[model samples]
Target: MSEGRHEDESQTRPSGISTDVEVGAAHAIQPPRLENGEKRTDTEADGQNDQVELGSSGRNTTQEKPYSVFSTNEKRIIILAGSLAGFFSPLTSSIYFPALGTIAKALHVSNSDVNLTVTTYLILQGLAPMVIAGFADNMGRRPAYMLCFTIYICANLGLGLQNSYAALLGLRCLQSAGSSGTIALANGLVGDTITSEQRGAYIAFASLGGLLGPTLSPIIGGLISQNLEWHWLFWFLLIFSGVFTVPLFLFLPETCRKIVGDGSIPPPPLNTSLTDVIRHKRRAKRGLVFDAAEQAELRKNYRFRFPNPLATLWILFDPASLVILVATGLNLACFYAISTGASAAFRDEYGFNDIQIGLVFIPIGVGGILAAFTTGKLVDWNYQRHAQRLGITVVKGVRQDLTDFPIETARIQVALPILLANGVFVIAYGWTVGHKISLAGPIIFLFFLGYCSIASYQVMNVLMTDLWPGQAAAATAANNFIRCELGAAASAAIGPMSKAFGQGWAYTFWALIYMAFAPALLIISRRGIQMRSAKKAREDKRSARRKEKMNRKG
Candidate 1:
C-alpha cells in the first residue's frame, strides 16, 4: 500500500482515538500501537496532553478541544452575530415585497419595470458573494462583514432618497451586493468553531435570523408602507442596520481559522475587534504573551490573496458539488415562484389589501422558523445514529474524520422525505390559489411549503459545509450563486406562467420541476464518496506536481 493510503487507513481505523497537537508546541509526540499492530499518529493517540498555554481566557486547556479552541458559549455568541448579519439579506428582499406596488406608482413605471428591480437584486445577490466569500476565507470574517455593512448602509441611503426608476434599479443592486454575502459568511463562521457532530444544530441556530426575515419582513413592510411613505422603508433598514452594525463592530471577534487558528493566535490589527484588543491587553497585564514565533508562522501560512470570483465557479466543475447546487437551486426557484406570485395573487384573487397580503405570509414564515429548530436537531441526531452504526467513536468538541463515514446518507436521509412533502405542498398551494378557494386553504399549504422547503434547504447547507471543510463560505456562495440565479429566473417568469396556465397549473409545473431533481439526491447519497475520493486524488496529484516544479527551480 502507498504511504498516503496507509495514513488514510490509520486515520479512519474504527478502534483509533482522536487527538490534536498542542498549539505552539515544537513537535507532537509519537503515539503507541493498537492491538492490531497499527501505529497511531499524533491525531490518533489516546489521552495526549495537547493543551495550548495562552491564559485562562483564550487557551485550549484540554486535549479534546476539537478542531477549534473556542468554547461552546463563545461559539454561540459568534454564530449569533453572524446570524444577525445574515438576517439582513432576506429581510432586505422580503421587506420590499409590500412596497413594490407603491414604488411602481411613485416612479411612474409599469409594474413589470418595477419587478426588474427584484430580478437585479437577486442577480447581485448571487454574484457579490463570489467575491466577498473568497475575501472572508482569505482575510477575516470581521473585515468582510464590515465591508458589506458599509456598502449596504450607503446603498440604503441612496435608495431612500432616489426618485427616478433608473436610480432605483441601480441602488437596489448595490443594496443586494451589501447584504447577500452575510449568509455565506455565517456558514463559514460555523465551520470555523463547531465540529461536524455539533454542526447541524449550530448551523440551524445560525440560520434562524435569516429564516425569520421572510416571516417578519412583509408585516413590517406593510405597516411602514401603510403608515408612512415607501421611502421610509429604506430609511428603516438604514437605521436598523446601522444599530446592529455597531454592536457587531465592537464585539464580534475574528474567528477565521486561517488567521486565528483555534482562537490561540492573536490576529492582525486590521482583523481585530475592540473586544479582541481588550482581551489581549488583559492577558498582557498578567505577563502572558503569545509565542512570537508561532504568530510569525501563522502569518507566513496565511499570505494575502486578492479575492478570486472565478474560484467560486471552479466548485461547479466537481460533479458531486454541481449536483447538490443544481438540485438545491431548483428547490429555491420553486420557493421564489411561490413568494413572487403571492402578493399579486392575493391582491387579485382574494381582494386582500396590502396589510392582509402581508398577514397571509405569516404561515409560510412561521413554517420556516419551526423547520429551522426541528430539522437541525433531526440532522444532528441522524449523524450520531450513523456514527454509532459505523462503530466510529464520536467525541464531543473533537472533529471526526469522515473519510469512511456515510455523511451523505446521514444528511440526505433527513431531507428526502421533506423534499417529497414540499412537492405535495407546492401542488396543493397552486390549486388552492387557482380555484380562488378560502384563504385557509392557501395559508395551510403555504405553512407546509415553508416547513418542507426550509428543512430540505437546511440539510443541503449542512452537507455543503461538510463537503468543503475550510471553504464553507465559498461552498455556500456557490450554492447562493446557483439558487439566486434560478430564483431570479423564476421570479421573472412566474407572473407570465401564472397568467398563461392559471395558478393551479403554473405551480403544478414548478412542483414537477422540483420533483425531477429528487433523484439527484439519491445519486449523491450512493456515489458521493467515490466522487469525493476521486477529486481528492486529482488534488493530491496537482499538489505533488507543484512541489516538484518548485524543487526543480530551487
Candidate 2:
C-alpha cells in the first residue's frame, strides 16, 4: 500500500480514540512509532501533556471552562460573528451610493458611466458569493473568511487611490468577491454552531443585516461624501472593516466541521498528504506539537477538490429551492424597487438631498429592526402554540412529535401581508407620483411597505434555513443568488418600464408580480408536511442501505 493511503487509514478513525492511539498512550516512557519512521522524542512527549490527560479519569473528566461547546455565552458570540460577516455586503453596496454623483463629477465621466460602476458592482456582488459559498463548505469557514476579507480590504484601499475607471471596476469586483463570502459564510457559521431550535433567532439576525447595513450605510456615506471627498468613503470602510476583523481574529473560535472533532456529522476531509504528516511529526519532535484536533483532522480523510457547482444549480432549480427562489426574488424585486425608487422618486417629489434621501431609509430600518427583534419571541411563541394545538411538548429541546406549526406556516403568514401591502403601495406610490399628490402620501405608503417587506423576508429566510437543516448556508446562498440578481435587473429595468408605460401602468405590473408570489407561499405551506414526509422516506432508504453494507462486512 502507498504510504499516503496508510496514513489516511490510520487517521480516519473516530475522535482519535482508536485502539492504537490509546495503546500508545498507555505507555509512559517509550516513544510511540511516528509515521515518519522516527520515534517520538522526549521533548515531544513533554509538550503533549495536555492531550495525554485525555486518558485520565477513564476519559470521563469534564471541565467547566468559561467556553465550551453549546454554551449560552458562546452562542451569543457566534451570533455576533455571523452578524458582522453579514453586514459587509450591504455596507459595500450602500456606502458607495451617496458618492456616485461625486464620482461622476470627479472622473469627468458621464453620469451613466458612473452608474455602470454601481451596476457592475451589483452584478459581481450577486455572482461571487455563490463561488465563495462553494469553497467555504469544502475548506471550512475560517480560511474562506480570512482570504475573502483580505481581498476586500485591499480592494477598498485601491478604490481610495485609483483614478481610472478601469482600475475602479477591477477593484470593485475584488471587493464584491470578498464581501460576497460574508452572507454565505455567516449562514454557514450559524449552521456550524447553532441547533435547529436556536437557529430561528440566529437566522433572524443574519436576515436583519439585509436591512441594517443599507439603513445605516447611506446615512454615514452621505455625511462623508457631502463634507469630505469620495475617497474618504473608502477610508471609512477600511477603518470600519478592521474594527470588526481585529476582534474576530482575537476571540472568534474556529467552528468549522473539520476543526471541531466529531463523527456524527460529515464534512469535506483534510487536504494534507502523508509527507505532510511526516513533516509535522518531525516538527513535533522538535518541540512543536500541533494542537491535538488539528494534527489528527488534517491527517484524516481524503482531500476534497471543489464539488460540481452544478449540484447547487440543480438544487436551486429544484421544486423546493425554486419556491424559495421566487418568494425571495419577489421580496428582492419589491425591496430594490423601493430602495432604487427612493432616490429619484423622493428627490423629485419631496426635493430631498442625499442626506435626506439616506434619512428616509430609516423607516425601512425601523420596520426591519422591530420585526427582527421580536421574531425570536414570535417564532418561539408560534412553536409553542403549534405544539399545544397539536398536543405535543418538547423535552430537553427536542420535540418528540412535530406539530402542525410547520416552518411554512410562518412563510404564509408573513407573505400574504407583505404581498398585499407591497402591491397596494406600488400602485399608490406610482399614481401619487404620476399626478401631484401629497408628498406625505408616498412616504406613508413606503413605511408600511417596509414593515411588510421585512416581515415577509424574515419568514422566508427562517423557513429556508429550517428546510435544509444541515445545508442551510448553501440554501441561503442559493436564495441570495436569485434575489440579488433579480433585484439588480429590476433596479435597472424599472425606470425604463415606468417611462415606457407610464408610472401607473408600470406599478400595476409590479403589483401583479407581488400577487403572483403570494400563491407560492401558500402552496409551500399547504404541501410542506407531504414534502417533508417524502424527504424522510428517502433518508430512511439511504439508512437502510448503509445498514445492509455494515451487515455484509460483519
Candidate 3:
C-alpha cells in the first residue's frame, strides 16, 4: 500500500475509490491512476485532507469503536432488568385467567362477561405501544420506564381494590398500557448495548421474560385462586410491581443509544446509573471522594429529544422487514390462540381442574426457553460461520459491515427448517387434542410448539436490530404492535374457531397459514442482498448531499 492525497484540482471525481468524506476534508486515498492516465496526488503537499490513509508499510489498520462502555456484569444486569420489566402484562393476563371464574362468581357477572376484560386488555396491549414506544425511542427510555411503572403500579392497586366490573375492565387496559411496552424497551436496550454479531443471544435471553410470563401465569394464578381469594392475584401483582420498580429506579442505566450513544457517550445526569449514584453516596458518607471531572465527562455526551415512533415506518415498510414481521406476527398469534383455547379444551375433555390445566402450560414454557437460549447462541455461531465463509472480517469488538455478506441466509436458512417443523407440531397437537388422546400426546407437541414458534421471532428480531440498530426501540415496538394486534385477534377467535371447525381441522388451517409464510422467507433470503444494497446506496447519496451542504456553509 502507498499513501497519497488528492490534490489535483482537475480531478473532480473518484477513481476506483470515491466515498463521501467530511466537509472541508480532502480525499486521502487517490487512485493509483486516473481514468485518463494521470496521478492526482503526484505533486500535492499534505494539503487540507483530514482523512488518514494506508502507509507505505502496507500494514492495514482500522480504528474501530469498542463494543460498549458497560462491563460484562453491567450488561447482564441490564438484561436482567429488561427481562423483569417485560415479564408483567402477559404473565399478569394469563395468571388472571385462572381467577376469571372466581371473579365472575364473586362479582355477579357471567364468565363470558369477564372474558371481555381479557379482550380489552389484549386490545389495549396492542394499541398502547403504538404511542408508548415513541417515548422510549424518542423521549428517553428512563422516563418512559418510570411512566409505565407508575401506571402499572397504580393500576394493579386499583384492580386489587376495585369491587366493580367496570373497574376491572378499565384497570386491565391501563395495566396493559403500562406493561406491554417492556418487550419493546428490552429489545431497544439490547440494540443499545450489544453489537450486531452478539445481539442474538442477548435478544433470546431478553425474550425469555415474555416466554416465561404466559407460561408461568396459570400455575401461579391457579394456586393463588385455588387456596386464597381471587383479589390476592392483583394484590400479588401490585407487590411484584413495587418490588421490581425499586431496582429499576435505583440501578437500571438508561441505554437508549439516541441519548447515550453506545455507552461511549455519557447520557444526562438523569440517565446515570442508580447503582453508581448509590455507591457514590455511600462512599462520600465514609469521607471518600472521586474525580468530579471523570463523572462529568460521561454525562456531557448525553442529550434528550422526542423520538418519533413514525420513524419506525421506514423499517416496517421495508420489504425485508415487512416480510419477517408478518411471519413472526402470525406465528405468535398461533401461540396466543392455542394458549387461549387450551385451557377450556383441556378442562372440558379431560375433566382437569384449574391447577391441573395450568400445569399443562409448563412444557411449552420450558421448551420455548430452551429454544430461546439455544437459538441465541446458534445465531451468533451461525453469523460467525457465515461471515468466515463470506470473507467478511468480523474484527473482534467492532461492528463491521456485511452489506454483501449474504446475512439473510445466515440468519434464516438454518432457522427455516426449525420454522417449518413447528407447523407439523401444531397440527399434531391439534389432532391429538381433537381426538382426546393420552395426556402426554398433546403436551409433548406443546413443547415443540413452543420451541418452533419462537425460532423465527428470535432470528428475525436479531436481524431487525441489525438492520436499524439506532432506532431499535422503535423497530421493536413496531414488531410488538404487529404481533400483539394479531395475538389479540387470535385470542378472540381461537375459541369460536375450535368449536366451529373441530380442533383437528382448525389446527390444520393454522398450520397451513404458517406454512404459507415460509415462501416469503425464501424470497427475502434470495432478494435481501439487492434490498440492502439499494438502501446503502440511498444512504450514501444522502451522506454526500449532507457533506456538500456542510462544505458550502463552511
Candidate with the greatest lDDT versus the true structure:
1
In TM-score terms, candidate 3 sits at: 0.82
What's the C-alpha lDDT at position 339 in model 2? 68
Looking at model 3, report the run of 10 residues with the lowest lDDT sum: 1-10
Which portions of model 2 show Cα errors greater than 4 Å?
1-68, 109-112, 261-304, 307-311, 396-405, 434-436, 535-554
lDDT of 1 by residue, 1-554 (tens): 22222222322222111121011111111221111221222332213344323232454333433345455676788898899899999999998887777788888997778878999999999999999987887788999999999999999999989889999999999999999999899988887777566776675678888788889999998889878989999999999999999989888999877677656568888899887887667657766555566566557646567877765777777677788888888888889888888888988898776777778889888999889888878987888776657554454444434555677788889988888889888999999998999888999999998898888988987887777766678888999999999999988888888999999899889889889888788988997677667666676676689789999999
Q: At residue 307, what lDDT does model 2 achieve? A: 39
Question: Candidates 1 and 3: which is better by lDDT?
Answer: 1
| Candidate 1: stretches off by over 4 Å | 1-62, 281-291, 301-304
Ranking by TM-score: 1, 3, 2
Question: Each prediction's TM-score against the native?
Answer: 0.88, 0.75, 0.82
**Global CA lDDT of candidate 3, please?**
0.68
Off by over 4 Å in 3: 1-63, 108-112, 276-308, 538-554
Residue pairs clashing, model 3:
138-307, 266-298
lDDT of each: 0.76, 0.60, 0.68
